[model samples]
Target: MDYLLSIIIFFPALASIFIFMMDNNVAKPYGITISLIEFILVMVLWMGFDYSNPNMQFENTFALITTYGINYHIGIDGISLFLLILNAFIIFLGTIYLNQPNDKNHLVVCLLLLESILMGVFSSLNMVLFYIFWEISLIPILYMIGAWGTGEKIYAALKFFLYTFTSSVIMFIGILYFAYLFFITTGKWSFDVLDWYTLTLPFDIQIWLFLAFFVSIAVKIPIFPFHTWLPHAYGDAPTLGSVILSAVLLKMGTYALIRFSLPFFPDASFALVVPIAILALFMVIYGGMLAFAQTDMKQVIAYSSISHMGVAVIGTFALNLEGLGGSIFTMFGHGIISGALFMLVGMIYHRKKTRQISEFGGLAQIMPKYATMFGIVMMANVGLPLTIGFIGEFFSLLGFFKSHPILTLLAGTSIILSAIYMLILYKKVFLGSIQNIKNLTLKDLCPREMTVMISFVVVIIFFGIYPKPILIPIQNSTQQLLQIMNDRAIKENTKIHLQNSLNKQKTALDTLHIQKLLKEVQYA
Candidate 1:
């Protein structure tokens, strides 16, 4: 299975060259065919996955840089498996939806390359390999925005690149520092993630190292203060670009928090939990308020993403199984619901040539099917019952409540606020008297677009009704993480206790020796 994971990760990349060479007339069909094959291969991997095991599956390693202690290692756990499937699913559907045979051949080629790098990021077991994939993945997106985006694409792409790139550089240094520490302790040089787990750093070192990693993941998650670039990126990117960014790319950050941050710095994580939760709380409330202030439908969803990610991150820092599970689950839900919402927004933009909510009204009267689908998706975005959105939000809030009941209650405002903004956006666009004459004759979704959206709707509804499949695997993964945290904590406490005992014994021995010397002097 070592090569199996590599094949899945790299095949699309190899296929991308062929895709790039193809004439425009055959590009769409060719892209779709390759993507279908890639997606099916992911399904095959899923069917053969050993659900009972929490350890990395299909593990493989290759010597890439022995001098630098870097190796090309790859594997998947339950947490990553579903995400890989999600990536494949979204890209495949996105290809079908992007059926512009005569246009944007280069864009299709870039997305294929992006898909391959993303798979590598999710599946890589070695820390350095993961970092390499992580950095490489950014190139296509930067190019996508600069080459294919609109309304200040260059500015948006440059900003996106600088923000994420700076963080990745910092994280690389942190990784190297930690790997060096591992070598010093055990006389072995390895950049394997599993090995790093056993190389515990002192408290002060952990704090600084954790910050280095945190900055990178937080920027990726784009939590609150760090989220300035996302709105522009989302708003400027093409429909397909926005969908891929929302559905798959953003998850990279949140997923990193779970995969690397929590395990590597458990004590620091435990200590910073309260402050981080507060930040999340603020992001949830503030981002929703800003969403309501937006006239551009795309910007509304953009701000809403910041708010949703806040909930996801807070759940992650809860450091408990339920919270951690909910964080991962919410990320999954956000990928589907938000991705669909972006697509819907793009559909509106393509038809009306504007994203202003005021440009639409009484769409239900003209386009019933489109209106109905938008309403359902809007409801999910608001975290209404019986939707995938509800599962992640409910569990995340519940997890926060365990430790910070008051913060949990305050953070709960996102649910209400999101509903308010989303519903208002929905009402303005789809209901009320027909304000714009242009909307009266707007075309409804084509079969291809409708099929793509309906597929997402089906996934959201399926998970909402029965999340057991997702929950079981996430639970196993989180349980193992918790065990490692507990073990680390216990060892630290034991070390402190033993040090104190040794100091006490040394003091007592000195006192007894002094008394014996005094008695001998008295006898002399």
Candidate 2:
């Protein structure tokens, strides 16, 4: 168990090298075995995790650059624990789905490497190490999309790389400047996020730094105007690529907003809430409309991702326990729901050799099992009650409503929009009489595909019914984060903002009956 975090972080990378050298015949089996082991390791970490403790656990630090004070520091709190598990779980399923004979060993290698890099991203406490992992993650994904993707794959890959990388460079500049400020304030050098949190920055400086970080995070979240690359990337990338991109990669931006932006620049976050909320509300309605307009199945899911992520963004900036917790939970919910949807679409494409919604009809007649699975996932996507998706959206809207009621009303439109588009998609794809000759003979879910779908359904429903286990830890962490933001606010206005938000958050929690649940969990 010693260095458990390090081992979990590096094992996939080491395994990728070995799998790369594997013969094409055994490569998939070896890759699956390796990924499964990694998943198990992550589950072990989760099992042993101290959910009641909000601070970082299993920390390991080493001075990688002594003079610059950039150490190889890593740890995880409740906020990061499930994200790590999610990364591992999704990669395991992705590897299993990539069982096509033509799936080269290198593809598996790229996936494993991406897993390792993302693991580091969620766990690293040092900003320098986090950035290193963050930047390196682009390589495998770029190669995956460019080499194995569909139409305009190379163009999509390049656009994705350019947009994300360019914005990241701006963030790096912010990181360096922020570090310099840290040195100036303390007469020492450090890129540790914990250390940086101790510094009380001027409101003016915080605004500049917040923008520097926000650009990169927004582009990754693909918020509004910056989201142009996503449809192409999702539409053209291979199914596995789409799954990973939607499920894990997109969350990176929202997660960073929670991990860095709110805490690092509380004043800026409080000051900019209205504008950010406006953009988020716009994305919610806009992405939903675009999703409704899509002909291609992949593109529909891609646009829906943008819409759902907007909710997460709103929750994050709500700057309270209900909003932050809901945002984090929504990230997980969206990951599972969206990934399942892409997988179902990929299965259809595999049989029909097309993703155009018009090409197929009455799929339920030919592929009842597949249709059923898709229906469940689609319902979750729509945020139907008692599904995993509902919990996050309900809390996110509730939390944000406390901060901005009118904006939350606009944001709530996403729920109706999502239901309309998703049900339309289901009806078009599965309800009508079979029209195409090819569709009449299409096969249903096979055993392998059934296994994956079943797993997704089980998790979705299980968590939906009883989310307290996850919610408790998330609330614990968000409480600590809010405390930090509250404690670090230098401006009187910022202090008042934090206090008002906290009061509203407390009221929301009480109304939702979550405070009772939290106290019970704590007593137990």
Q: Candidates' TM-scores? A: 0.92, 0.97
* Model 2 lDDT per residue over 13-35, tens place: 99888765668878777888989
Q: After superposition, how far is residue 201 of candidate 1 from its true place, in Å?
A: 1.3
Worst 10 residues of 1 by lDDT: 509-518
The lDDT per prediction is 0.82, 0.90
Which candidate tops lDDT?
2
Q: Candidate 1's residue-wise lDDT over 318-358, tens digit each? A: 67655777898898899999888988888878788899887
The pairs that clash in candidate 1 are none
